[model samples]
Target chain A: MQLEEQTITIDGQKIPFQSGQTIMDAALAAKIYIPHLCYHPEFKPHGSCRLCTVMVNGRYESACTMPSVAGQEILNNTKELNENRRALTQMLFVEGNHICPGCPKTGNCQLQAVAYYVGMLSSHYQHFYPYRDLDPSHPDYVVDFNRCILCELCVRASRDVDKKNIFAISGRGIKAHLIINSPSGKLEDTDFAVGDKAAFVCPVGAILRKRTRYTTPIGERLYDKQSIRIVGDSQQLHAGATKYGRK
Target chain B: MIESLEGKRGVPRNRPPFPVTQGYLNKPTVVNNVETFALAARIAVYGGDGFAALGTKQSKGTKLLSISGDCLRPGIYEFPFGVSVREVLEACNAQDTQAVQISGAAGTCLSAKEFDRKIAFEDVATGGSVMIFNRQRDLLEVVRNFAHFFVHESCGFCTPCRVGTSLLKNLVEKVYTNHGTADDLKDMSYISQVLKTASHCGLGQTASNHIADTLKKFPEIYHKRLLVEANFEPAFDLDSALEDARQITGRKDEMAYL
Candidate 1:
């Protein structure tokens, strides 16, 4: 009976966590992993990825978005939640050009790890058939369009937190494209510097540091050994901040 | 306007020789919008007051709203004359909205802040309400998709609607894909304006006017990407330039995909 303890049950495990704690954060602290994307520790929580799906009291929800109310009973690690997570992951995988063999970050990628963890064997939807262009605009960084998932986490990080509305979604529906704020639609013309959150926010290998591809093997990558819940356990406070990150 | 129930199925490949030369059924036949005929009928029946009962005092009669947006409940709702947008949104349990796009696919778009404003014929057209897009929805993309619809449905009869709608689709897509220049936006604005005035039929002209209306209301949303002098770069990488080139390269050999 710690003063910080709150009465809550997650997947039938009664756990004591601090008040004002997020369900994801509390669950991760208690060793209950919730699959998630767009819930980064270094940056803000962006719930747009919708990959961290879980059920709370019989209702499906994005675990990354919902906050735990006192006396609430939450459920994660369910068959249905895992299925939906797998399906949504497969969608992002197939929607872009995710050639695992050709991708440098294949083993180390968060998106790939999520796919593997969720049991996404193959894609059910049609490949977007988009001809992605390689942006060699920055001499130190490279942007490959084929691997982007349109999560908008980078856009939010660059705009709301970073005070730069650098990213915007163009087109509609199936034909939607992401446009850089540069002349001739090239990233080189704009102030897109390396190490900016926009350049590295991609969960996939779409945007990569030019020389970092072969520097680290897939097994030693950040996403390989740890669950996203563990990495994002602290920053889950921002889950309900925006529409993208909300429950 | 010489119109017939029989002409419902097979439209003409070219202008009928008889409509202009011989005239409709050997008599001069002129075509007009059913709305005009309905108005004329209203003048005869209600003498404007009865029609006025449906709409506001200034705009008498029932008009439609093509509202397509993100609302807890979204659809065409018939309201009495002078019913404000706030009232309409309230009646539908869609109040406290994030955004509101008034008019049809081709009319003025106002956000939730503007919902307190009145809903009049001056605001919405005489046609039925078509759609309403909520804040979660994207307006630029909505109008762009609608333009594509018009482009494909065009009968290709008149230059203004057929050619003009296609041109409009191209322009709207260009603005959407971030390839449009400031000159392209100007051209887009100009083409929509001209088509609104010059298209032979209402379908070709008014059907796509939402693009113009949205641009007028939210011009910043439609600003061409490459043309804007800014320090920001998009978060996601886009390689549309190669796709555009590929399209141009294969245009001649490609079959139409409408």
Candidate 2:
């Protein structure tokens, strides 16, 4: 049985997509950038960021979460939408202590790159300097809760990919934090390995590997070489395949 | 709300498998307003024809409006759905009315010119609330008050609602405190648009609704509050930034302040 190719119109461009693929998957596959965070190709789509929002049939829907319907009209990357995206990026910047220049993952950070891509010139909002304690309990990995965006990538990776259940998000709303699933509530106390998928799943400088700071320098980092739209995500590229990226 | 009712956090759930398909206890549930429940009860007792016979051609039955603010009769009044704002005001003995804030803080603001507008779904859709604002009332104060409400109520689940509300509150506070400039007013509109467009839930989406409505309908109030010459006012005051250090050292000296 042969199925006809399904296409969804984004910014007046008709891009073909598979039946089961989301708007993000189809758009990214076709090299169309719909700015998003908290959406990895390998993980389930979490529409918390609201950056990938598009006007679908006069209403807003998250592109990463919405299923691609044939002949559906989606408005993305418009002036109005880009402005809103910049505001959302600013919200993310103000939500945490995302000091890009001061962090080790400055150039390599997706949040910083996306901020640049969205034309976020200023923080725009008041900084929420919520006191967060740094976790140096683990000998090899340093956990900096200051940079966490509450994206739950590490939580999803530890639970789903590693099957270790090492990380979990505790509390609710602004009080929510990435918690280590150990009796002592520390990463070192858990049976977490350095090679775990959760260790490298962070899109920011929240989680860091010890003694690897400034190894590649700032300008020579992954995101510094190319924009995130071109390189997709670092996780897929380092896997030696472009499964969810340009082939 | 369903999550909170089920002993979970007060954060809103993401949509797709909506509350109809997957709600509290993962069962199909119909979430309705108190007014809607009252309507449902009335519909159950009286036939559909009886209810439909009242009001305008489009809107059916009566609406319960809790009329508050600068009105003489400050109580809930049951009027037909097509009742105009002027009629509501007259019924409540409201005098010298400048504007009418329909629904609630996150609803539309009607100027004296729009008093002819009716309380219908097609005309001025509201959940049955009409707060009157007389000529003596300052609407910017109202905006500031509502802004604080939204900031405290925000669940902080999503980035847009969580941060946007606080930003809106801060901006409104800045304006209220006379630290606002023309740029601050522009920034307020931009932030309001973002909150309206990208917020995850209705609370965040309509958090700045009254602000937007008042900005368009009553621009003078906001413009009058702006600085005479300054176009930019830094929210980060150098003196206020040293408050933590001042508190730590327990100093009242001028040098210790800044």
Best by lDDT: 2
How many residue pairs collide in each prediction? 26, 0
Each candidate: chain B TM-score: 0.66, 0.92
lDDT by residue (tens digit), candidate 1, B33-52: 66668678868976865765
Query: Which residue ranges in model 1 land beyond 4 Å of their true spot?
Result: A1-4, A17-20, A41-44, A218-247, B1-258
Cα lDDT of model 1 by residue, A1-247, tens digit: 6656575687888976665556666676676777766665445444545556565676555455466667778777767667656655765665578898799877667787777677778864334456878888778777787887766666766776656666665553334456676657776666767646565566677667788688877676555666554543212212333222223
Query: How far off is residue B137 in model 1, in Å?
Result: 32
Model 2: per-residue Cα lDDT over B1-258, one tens digit each = 799889865777777668899998888889998888988898998869989998889899898999999989999899998999999999999999999999898899999999999999899988877899899998888888898888777777677877877887888888788788888878888888888888888888898887788878998888887766488888888888888888899998977854
Which residue runs of candidate 2 sit more than 4 Å off their true CA positions? A159-185, A237-247, B5-7, B243-258
